[model samples]
Target: MEVLRIILTQSSANYKKEETILNKMTYPLPPFSTVIGAIHGACGYKEYHKMDISIQGKYDAMHKEPYRDYCFLNSIGEGDRGTLVKLNNKNFLSTGFDKVAEAKKQQGSSFREGTTIQVMNQELLTEYRELKDLLDRIKDFEENRVDKVLKLIKKRKKDLADKKKKVKENKEALNVVLIREKQIKELEKNINDRIKAYKVNEYEIPYSNFAILTTSLKYYEVLNNIELIIHIKSDKETLMDIKDNIYNLKSIGRSEDFVDIKDASIVEVVDTIDGPITSEYSAYIDYNLIKNECVFLKLGDKITANGTKYYINKDYVIEDNKRIFNKKKVVYTSEYVAEEGSENLHFDISSEKSYIVNFN
Candidate 1:
C-alpha cells in the first residue's frame, strides 16, 4: 500500500485539486490522513464518495459550533486556484505583532542617533569652558605685567630728571670758575706790565700807584670799580716815587703833582696818553688790548691796517711802553748763484716758533 501511495503522490496537480475539494467541505484533515483522502477523492469512485460525505458531515457540525463564527474564506490563484481561510483573532494578533516589531526598530535607531548628539554637545561645552578659563588667565597676566612696566617707566623718568638737575648745576659752577679765572688773569697782566715798564726787580709794587694807574688808564672797564681800587699812601712821597726809587730810575716817569695839577684838563689828552700803543722799541702791542685771550683772530680773519701786516695779540694793555722792540725781522745770505730750473724753483721752510701775522 505504501508503494502505491508513493506512485499516486507523483502527480502534484491532481493532489492539490483533491486537497481543495476536501478543504471546502469542512473536513477535519487527519494527522497523516491527507494521502489517503487525496487518493480516494482523485479516484472519484462511488464507494469512496459515501465515506467522504459522511466524514465531511461530521467535520461540518464541529466547525459550526466553534470555528465558523470567527473564520472567513478567501481564494487566490496564480497558475491554479488556491483557497485560504483567515481567522479574525489571528489577523488582530498578527497586526499587533508587526506594529511592535516596527516600533522596536525605530526606537533602536532613535536611541543611537540621540546618544551621538548628546556626546557631541557635552564635548563642545567642555571645550568652551576651557577656552573661557584660558582667556581669563591671559587677561590677568597681561594686566599685571602692564602694571609692572608702568612702575618701571615712572622710575626711569625720575632718574632722568635727577640726572638733568645734576648736569645743570655742574654747568653753572663751570661758568662761575671761568669768569673768576678771566678776572685774575687780567689783574696779573696789568701788574706785570707795570713792573716791566718801571724796571722793578722786586715783586712788591705800591698798591696806591697800582690803583691810580689802573683807574686812570681804565683797564678792564667791565670789572666793578670798587673791586679794582686799593688804597696805599705815605706821607713822604707818592707810590710812583717809591717804584722809581726801587728800580734805581730804570723807567721814565713824570711827577705825580703834574698829573694831579692837569687833572682838571681835557679828558682827551689824558686818554690818548693812557691808551695802548704799538710804538717801536715798546714791548706792548696796541691791538692786543681789544682781543679776548680765549678767542684768537687767525691769519684768515678780516682786518684793516696801514702797514704791511699786523696781528692782534691775546692780551690787552692800558698804556704804551716807549722803550721796547715790537717788529719782527728776517735776513738771508747766499754766495752762489745758479740757473733757475724746475727742481730749484721750490723752497721748503719749517719752524717751531709761531709768527703773528694779520689777515684782511
Candidate 2:
C-alpha cells in the first residue's frame, strides 16, 4: 500500500496553528500511512465543497493503494490561519514529494539538536569594507590626477607663449642694430674717399699728417667734432663689425630655441608617409603597428592600382586589406606596421576588430 506524509517542522509557528485548527491538541507522531489517508480525505472534502467534484469517485479512488502515495498535504503560513490542502502527487512529480516528506519526518525531532558555531567574523567584514573604501578613494584620486595634468599643460602653454614673444622682440632689436652698423660702414667709406681727393690737390701735407688722420679718428668723433666747430659733418657712423657680432650671437640663440606647436598639413603628410619627413618644420609621427611595405606618394603622384593609375589628390583614397586611407580618415586594421629597418616611424594598429571605411 502507498502512503503520504505531512511532516511539519517545529521551527515554523504555522505547525502550532495547524494543530489547533485540526482540533489536534498536540502534533501527534502519526505513521506515514495514517497521514496519507487523512490527506486524501481532506482533498475529497475540499473538492466536494467547491462543487467541482462529487464525493462518489473520490472515495472510490481513495481505496486504490497505487494512488495513495500520490496524495500530499502542504501546510504553509502561521497561527490558526495556516493552510491545509490535499494535492495530487502529479503536482509534486519532479519534487520527489514522497522522499521530501520522509526526510522531513526524520528530521522533525532533531531540528534544533545541533551545536552552533560562529562562522562570520565581524573583523573580516570590517576589513573588506575598508578595502572597498580604499579602492573607491583610489578611483577618485586618479580622476583628480587627470585634472591636475590638464591644468599643468595649460600653464606650460601660457609660459611658452610669453617666452616666444620675448624672443621675437629681442630679434627685432638686434636687427635694428645691424641696420645702423651697415650705414656706419658706408659713411666711413665716403669719408676716406673725400680725404684722398683733398690730398691729391697738392697741399704740402701728406694725407697721413692731416690732424683729422693723425688722431686715431673716431668715426663718431670725426662727424660730431667737425660739425660742432665748422658746422660741417661727415655722414659717417661706427661699430659695424660689433653689430654683426651681436647678430651672430642672436642667431645662435635662435638655433637653441625650442617651442612646441602644431601644423595640420605637416601632420597629415607625416601620417601619410607613416614616418617623419625632413621638412622645413619640425614634427613627430607615431605608429602603432609594424608593416612590411609602404607606398610613398607626393603631390599629384599617380598610383597605379588594379591596372589603373589613380591620380591622387590631398583627398585621395588608398586601400589595403588591413587599412583604408582617405584624406582625413585613417583606419588601422591591425597594429601600426612599419617596413623592416624603418624604426624611426611607428603606426598605431592595436585594434583587432574589423572596421568599415567611409568618409564625409
What are the lDDT figures for the candidates, one per model? 0.23, 0.23
Q: Which regions of candidate 1 deviate over 4 angstroms?
A: 1-120, 168-360
lDDT of 2 by residue, 1-360 (tens): 011111121111100112232122211111112222232343332321111000000000111011111222232211211111212243343333111111122222211121121213344324333443554554575467644654655565566555555666688765655555555556555655654454344321221111100011111100000000000011112122212222222100012221121110100101233342211111111111111223222224422111111111112224565433222112211121222223233221113311111111
Per-model TM against the reference:
0.13, 0.13
Write out the backbone clash pairs for model 1. Answer: 281-324, 282-324, 289-316
Candidate 2 lDDT trough over 10 residues, lowest sum: 223-232
